[model samples]
Target: MAILVAFGTIDGAGLARSEDTSVDALQLHGPLARLLRPLVRLFIRTGMTFPALSQLLRELYINVAEYDFALPDKAQTDSRVSLLTGIHRKEVSRLRGAGAPVNVVPAALSRTSRIIAYWLAAPDYTDTTGAPLPLPRAGEAPSFEALVSTLTKDVRARAVLDEWLDRKLVSLDEEGRIRLEEKAFVPQNGSEQQLYYFGRNLHDHIAAAVENVLGQAPAFFERAVHYDDLSGPLAAKLETRSRDLAMNVLQEANREAHSACETDAGGDWRWIFGIYVYREQMKPADKDIGKDAS
Candidate 1:
């Protein structure tokens, strides 16, 4: 006998089978609405209409059904995809020929990120305390030139320096040594690089949540601390403390990963460790609504 669970079924052998369970649409509605609210807000602010988003979602539905839900050793048919996604068979057939969305990291963004990672982690570029050291603009080992050259010799170190200077990612100290800014990892506002990360990070976070919700084993780390009521001063203090702790964790992880990768045989596997903090003022009406629901 198989014991049915909210998400799936556990067989007599004690193995869970997620495919045996049907998804409850009502169970998903509240969560889906919460997830889509901010995204829909972004679309409206960016002038993306409902029709445009609908078309994009239609294509994605077909793509996911065809690729992700396909049976082993079986050709995916339009009818099957249509049934899985609740999209019309004709629409599924039309989109089946369309290319899947490509996930390409911008060249400049990739290069810059790697360079910063190395600077933060490599012993030569960091101090005894593991902080990135200010480097001479040009010279021998430990200089900015050496750091850039270690990553790539195709682009001249001076050219890279100039670009970083223009973007204010790095600044020259009184001694003319180049110092990386604290916010160097952040891309320019409204830039292509920023948008790329916005999509990629959100997608990864949501994917982890979905995997856990689907009762997948070996769940990814997903946890948050929340407080509804706090004085302004208390909230500010907590926010500052949170930022410091988060940065310490990120920097330590970066150092460890950097050392591991030095001798790591490169493979198709990729990993991301991300942290985010958000604070919003609660309106009186919103508080009342919450009280009523509770």
Candidate 2:
């Protein structure tokens, strides 16, 4: 339920390259202090919360070096993760897996093995009789045939990969051929480094959301609803679960920011969504409700 908010290409921040724009600054640095300036009385709005999109980031392939989570303002967490992280729910519903993030071979494949496999398997590829295709490089999406041609050369592996591809762990190019099919999304960079950016992006998002909440909240909220109480290490947890929630956020924020969303809002406001994995879990609570119903 913790959602990582990202302003995709829609915001005009480049998805494939980092831009030194103010939006990128908002993503990399906290701006509540500055945003508060000259705008307190100015009307503002909290943008849409893309909880499903956050989970998609985890389940799908994010070429960290190539793609940045652009949060021009701020991003915030959804409420469910916040709630669920507290009570180790006795009846935790299993969130369906985010499909394999690309079907590329695991990085563990050593150089020599890659060579051997390429030689032995490349020829067997169909146009894929079926050997899997090589994974695409960051930002270099490929067509299905191209992906299949690269990863595999025979049938059996292709079948398994085909299943994964259908499920979205892999995606094809315009030709309806396999392209970005790397299954194992190993952090090509240091794991911590990758997580750090993920968390920062998430961090910026949540901060922005909370900023909106704080700015919109009544001049003085009751203790239970105060901004600080809902954020920080102290808010969102019972005494027993505080540290757990804090640590969970700590480890994940650097890896994925919405880990905080779980705690953002509890009760009816919460939702769990991950398009690449559990997107199917969501549906209209009532057909008559608007998109904002959640």
lDDT per residue as tens, model 1, 191-211? 887888998998887787677
Stretches of candidate 2 off by over 4 Å are 1-193, 216-294
Task: List clash counts for every candidate, in order.
Answer: 0, 45
RMSD of 1: 6.5
lDDT of 1: 0.80
Model 2 TM-score, all chains together: 0.17
| Per-residue accuracy of model 2 over 1-294 as CA lDDT, tens digit each | 122232322221212222332343355343444344323333233332357444544333222211233235653222332232332222112322223332243342332233332322333321242334444322332323343344455534456456555645457566554443333332334444344434454444444444433343322111111111123333434443644554444333322323343366655652221111111122344222222322
TM-score per candidate: 0.88, 0.17
Where model 1 places Cα greater than 4 Å from the true spot, the runs are 1-22, 97-102, 285-294
- The whole-model lDDT of each prediction reads 0.80, 0.34
Predictions: Cα RMSD each: 6.5, 22.8
